[model samples]
Target chain A: MTLSEKNLKNEIYDFKKFYHLIKAFTISTNISCKAFNLNGEKIASFKGPESDTSFCKLIQKLNQEKNYCMQSYIYGGQQSEKLGEAYIYFCPYGLVNWTVPVIKENKVRCFLTAGPVLMHEVDNLLVENAVKMCPMLDKRRKEIKSKLSKIIVVDTIRVKYLADLLLKLAKIIMAEDAVDLNNKHELNIFNAHLVENINEIKRTYTLQGKNNKISNFQEKEANLITKVTSGDKEGAKKSLNQFLGYIFFYNADNIEIIKCKVIELMIRLLQVVTEVGVDYNVVSGIKYKYLKNLINAGDFNEISKNILEVLDYLIDCLTPLINVKNRNTILIAINYIRNNYHKDINLEEVAAQVGLHPVNLSKMFKKETGKKYTDYLNEVRIEASKNLLLRDDLPLVQVAFSVGFNDQSYFSKIFKKIEGVSPNKWRVLQKEQKNFN
Target chain B: MDREILNELTVALQKGDAIKTQKFVKIALKKGYEPEQILTEGLVSSMNTIAEKFKKKQIFVPDLLLATRAMNAGIFILKPKLKKQLFSPIGKVLIGTIEGDLHDIGKNLVKVFLERAGFEVIDLGNDVPVNYFIEAIKKFKPQILGLSASLTTTMYGMRDVIKALEKEGLRENLLIVVGGVPITESFATGIGADIYDMDGTKVADKAKEKLKCSNF
Candidate 1:
């Protein structure tokens, strides 16, 4: 599904609402429930009063690893669709679970699962097989055996009835959500139209003109392109912004024309970088695609932002090929920083490795790289930390320590100062953006 | 009937106090005020004020959203009562964010404005597939269809939906309006859309204009 579709689904099947609904149901019925997308990714789950059964957890873990639960959901979805009702069956764990496919326009969009209810006495043979399948369960043998004894049993007819009732309730909730969304949309449009009319009136009187200083514009653009090809990112960024400012000021009335001019500028910049030995494939691949996106940009601000990103990419791509006077020393220092960022290494050690005095090395680094030694080291560490943060398995403190910051608080403080958000928030944003994209 | 109670209800709605709005709605109903009177004077009047404030830049998106919530709180109570009376809408509209686009805040805002303008709106929700749009058009038989897409990649879906509508021989029957971050007037014209707006704020007026032109 597209990001918009996922968002709509999210809005329709509100997580908090579903969580509370399932929680309330669990409280009343002692039946745990979970919702999953078509991919079997658990959207939300609620634990019932009976959820702490050790045996159930073990079986669930095993089932997750083997994808037995997801398989059952898929099978159940097929059955539910075919029969035009919810599908209920005994899982491999010998507990009854029901799956309801939320069908829209003949497509199964999501599934609701409610179960792990024992319809009969727990069989000892099933337990033995589960234990054998997972030897780790041997350590919890006594706990599992005891929990197994406490398993509640219900009649098949009652279980089926409860499943059917829950499915109907889920359907009703979804329908109501649709109505609520429609209502909200209507209200928003009503408010927005009035604002738009006033803005349109104000815009009608705004004056716009073209800059007659087009004589030097091309020369200045060429210089900026040259800077990007030489890997002068800071210079290129400054020039790009100045050019955008000129475009915005002069062509404010005609966004489409400005968009066209910006695309032309980007293409010229790409050609210059490619001429400077940046791979043709890389430039060609992104140039037209980025140009298309730039052309489709909504307004001056969006177009300028896209152009800036393009310039940044060009500079990054050309940086390795740009020949610097102190390339050897800087490369050695950079290599050392990359390799030992996780350890306590000072500028003195790095300078000594490069056979230069610390003061001379620091000055040389700043002059050549446009950043101080400490800042450069921090950038390298921060970059490393970003990679570590991408892995959901790693805790924030571990990520900090793994990237050489012994103090998690200091690490988080530095991260926020650099990234504009806390480490955990950044991780979450990255994950959410990654999921949607 | 005390006019002050209706005034208080309007204030609650403007303040986005859902609980207070609901309370005042009940109070107005209990005071023997007709449901239609309460809706027009209490809820709709507050919404109009909000819309004007929004137009003058005195309030923004969050404020608009909250005010809408407040109005809905009152509307929910009045809906059942108003059902007993004849409450004909201006026209019906079907709206959705196109498939592969997850942006609906804009679309939702449009839906709200159209409804407030007395149009009966059927929102298909975001990331709606082309076939679903076709199916909805056929089922709702709306006077207008609004398609929204925020991403360049997904904006193509709007054109696809338009094409699908034409394929189903349903294109000429209804007015097609397209909007979103990436949608341009030129793009809309190229795709044979009847109207295009940059945002939801102007959609209601544009829809009204289209309806007038089509004599619907």
Candidate 2:
């Protein structure tokens, strides 16, 4: 199941119990912390000594007004869970906020935000403007000013470390709660009810929007499907999100219309799958199952999640076919290396040409060709040098330089390593073989 | 002799408690249990269970590695005593990761599995030069030479080793087995290797098969 569908909000997390556990942590660290659901609703909080500072209050007010909390949630939540890292950013008020996503089942269910801690000396003017924005804090101006003087400035490294620690603790708590809920059928019912209520509100707003601006996303859809078929995972996700955004933009609050549009999109995707030569039965089964999930999806997120899952499955099915693209990349790299064997070439340059990380390219190069990047390059250069060496008068140093090597000694060393003889010995041996033939 | 101590040794090996396994072996030896009986019933039998679980996907790489360590600990204590026994290994095998490739996890797993299956394994370790492999084969006179290279770049090292053997006329004297993530059966065959196993557990079985076919 998708993480959002896990109903983590309904999982009986005792805020009082958690607050008690982390109260000392917040106080000692001088960092105020809060947890929020995916919808930007605060679930619980731990106020540190600096929390009541006028600057802190002003920053919180500005965040609510500017929707910075929601922005941070969206920004941090977008990072893939596989990376297992938290997103850190500075709020507009100049205080650093670290957003740690609590991911479950490979989806972010909630976020633990720790911050308003200064990463630098407090800026008085920014603090003044914050106070001006929230005039209700005028009475506490003297106290706020005093507190801002003692503002705790933490290093970015420490902030990140703490954020990771909180993330681990949150994961442990979630796991423990999930295990506890396994035996509680009544709690499951309550969680299902809570999810239904949340989904009901989403469905109501979804159906209320007008259907307009449904442009021809057909070209974009086809591009997205191509990316999926080619096993461009990151590219496919980006395109899918953009395509879904366009669909939601025009057909917001309309589940029935969105469902039909999604089904149409699926059919187009299925055609691509068939062209890729995935088993017919598997393709049909996936299409049927995805359609059922899409139609029954309660919210936009659910529908999007279902679509992404189907895309992921199709990408997996197309993995063997995707090797054709990898083969092309390897061929292109090989050609580049061979054509440029007379000059300098390295893994990084060739990797950039193929738009892959050097390490990944290195691994792929070895897997596809059974030769290391440098080894292949050396082989090409050595072969070229052999042809140059055939001439009776070509100097060995010039031969080395002509085939991309800077030093005759190094080139000779590699040549002997591969051919099991020095260049001069190889020349004499080749001539001997020639006379025998 | 208390049979319970042998059972405890098996459990300790399964749990990957190397020190505990060694202690239990010492206890079993002091209790007048035959070293061969302890080796087979306690250590090898536990590795067999672990291998079976690994095949069934009940355990993973880390678990197998730990179990191997515990089994090795128990076997280390029994090796001296086993030397005096009339224990003949099924075969001798020399193995190493090929030159310019430092990956050895796969090679180590294969070596451990082979040793567990009663083969005398001479591990040449990672980044072994082609000359080292040839020299080791000559010195060790092993029936099988296993070449492992995880990188695509170093896989050619396997081919080079095979060619070197052929050049020295030693190729016919030994069965060459090749393995690694990048070494498929086709790649092994292309390199003229006698056997290829994707899973390290099956390497021992393949080695045995090759030995039987050659009437070793």
Q: All models: lDDT?
A: 0.71, 0.70
User: Candidate 2 deviates by what RMSD?
Assistant: 36.8
Task: Looking at model 2 chain A, report the run of 10 residues with the lowest lDDT sum.
Answer: A181-190
For all the predictions, what are the DockQ values? 0.09, 0.01
User: Model 1 Cα displacement at A252 (Å)?
Assistant: 16
The TM-scores of all predictions, comma-separated, are 0.41, 0.35
TM accuracy, model 1 = 0.41
Residues A1-437 of candidate 1 have per-residue lDDT tens digits of 11233433543445455555666777888877776776676766666776645666657776557876677676665555444456676565545677776644435567778877765455454466557766677777666767766766665556767777777766665664334333333333322332243233223324322334575467668778767865777777666655654554345446688898899898888878778778899988888788789878876546765776688788888777765536778889989999999998899999999998899789878977899999888888888999999999999899989988889998998888889999899999999999999
For candidate 2, write residues A397-436 as lDDT tens digits: 9999999999999999999999999999998998888889
Residue-level lDDT for A116 in candidate 2: 65
Instruction: State model 2's lDDT.
Output: 0.70
Candidate 2 lDDT score at position A300: 56
Badly placed stretches (over 4 Å) of model 2 are A1-116, A119-143, A155-165, A172-218, A245-258, A274-277, A296-302, A320-367, A370-424, A427-437, B1-216
